[model samples]
Target: MAKIKTIIDGIEVEVERDSWAIDVARELGIDIPTLCYHPALGPYGACRLCVVEVTKSKWTWLATACDLPIREELSIKTNTPEVIRSRKMAMELIMARAPRAESLFPLAEKLGVTKPRFKCRDDIGNCILCGLCVRMCDQIIGVSAINFANRGHKRIVTTPLHKKADKCIGCNVCVEVCPTGHVKTLDDGSFRHMQTWDADLEMLHCLICDKPYIPAKQFKVISDKLEGIELKRICPVCRRKETVDNLRYAVVEKVS
Candidate 1:
């Protein structure tokens, strides 16, 4: 490991090169607040909450600690007046767009931000579009079911072609990874559906038989009776033959 020297809160600290500034700070017992920085996923630096002033040789600028790599002879200032102001502003902006939950209130108080300064959007509640959920689903889980669509203020997360997503495995990994409870999973009698800021699942019907095969998760409660049954896009006649054949083969193997 290469030696990395950096200044945090005017104190010199040495770290391993290629380590993130956030990890370095944590080692030094300095807390840098962040929202989208997950250890399991790549840092997008979208939240802008962990910005810190860094001076490396001649170049000096604000960089995100979550994304910045420590180098030799790097100086980092994490708790200056300017840094505190910027952090407070970022927290206020995020709070304005987030739900008024009890968890956020104490954090706001700790950051010295009493109230939000900007106008709150009507659609703003839980999600800040930090891309943590999307990155985890795409990079970690290898399921590209959800992504950002549109642009700027009109931007929203959606499935491909803005159509009902057929690739979602109902794994609920997205929900578990989200920092805010923006994505919710509800169980209907036929299947489990997820609700997020941008989209909802549509009721599914069998194309060949025109039977109501799946209801929206928010509409009905799933019962334990239908737990192991797989709901595929097939009619009862096709499913009966497949199930019977599998059972027959299992019985023959047991006897043999």
Candidate 2:
């Protein structure tokens, strides 16, 4: 990879070309806040919280640092008044949309937004419409179970027809990736329920402990991917115990 020299907050630093501006800034100890940015997901820039002022010759403008690729002679100002104002505005709007989101409060305070000037209905849940959940299911998990529905004010993440998602494997990737506490899943021994997507999948019991470990559909996905490798239907704890027991037996035999 080629190296490029970029100026961040007036400090010149050499970084790998094609690296994101936000990543480089973070590595340089420059605090750039973000919500819709994740190392795994690779920068969707939906939140607009990581905005930074970019200067190139006479042209100067603000851009989201999450997806801004590092280029030659790129100049970035992370904590300028313009950048701070932009982030605060984005945070304020996000707070209004997700008023009940406990996670946003800390970030909100950090950005100096005590309260949002805009007000939304109380029914607006913690979903910030970041698309992390939708992207995780479709891109990484290879299951297009849930997606954005409707437009503008009526926009929401939901399964098709607001019914049970047939393609969902109950993997809980959506739940894990959700920044807000919007996506939820519940396990009641026999079944794993993805409440957000309206999916209920049968749980696969551990062969050794007889405890429900993983969802059957999720196990099938893993099984299919591994091909000929024989997989035991045991939980992680039992698998570790079995490995230890096998090693102990081998040691005893050798000793005898």
TM-score for each candidate, following the candidate numbering: 0.71, 0.92
Give the alpha carbon lDDT tens digit for every residue of 201-243 in model 1: 5555556665545544422223323576644665466578779
Model 2 Cα displacement at 109 (Å)?
A: 1.1
Top TM-score model? 2
User: How high is the CA lDDT of each candidate model?
Assistant: 0.73, 0.89
Give the alpha carbon lDDT tens digit for every residue of 1-256 in model 2. Answer: 8788889988899998899899899998988888888788777999999999999888999999998998778889988899889999999999989988887889899999887999764775799999999998888888889899999988999899988899999999888878888899999979998887788999999998999999999999998889989778999999999999999999999999
- Highest lDDT against the true fold, candidate: 2
* Model 2 bad stretches (over 4 Å): 244-256
Model 1, runs deviating above 4 Å: 57-60, 99-102, 188-190, 197-256
What TM-score quantifies how close candidate 1 is to the native fold? 0.71
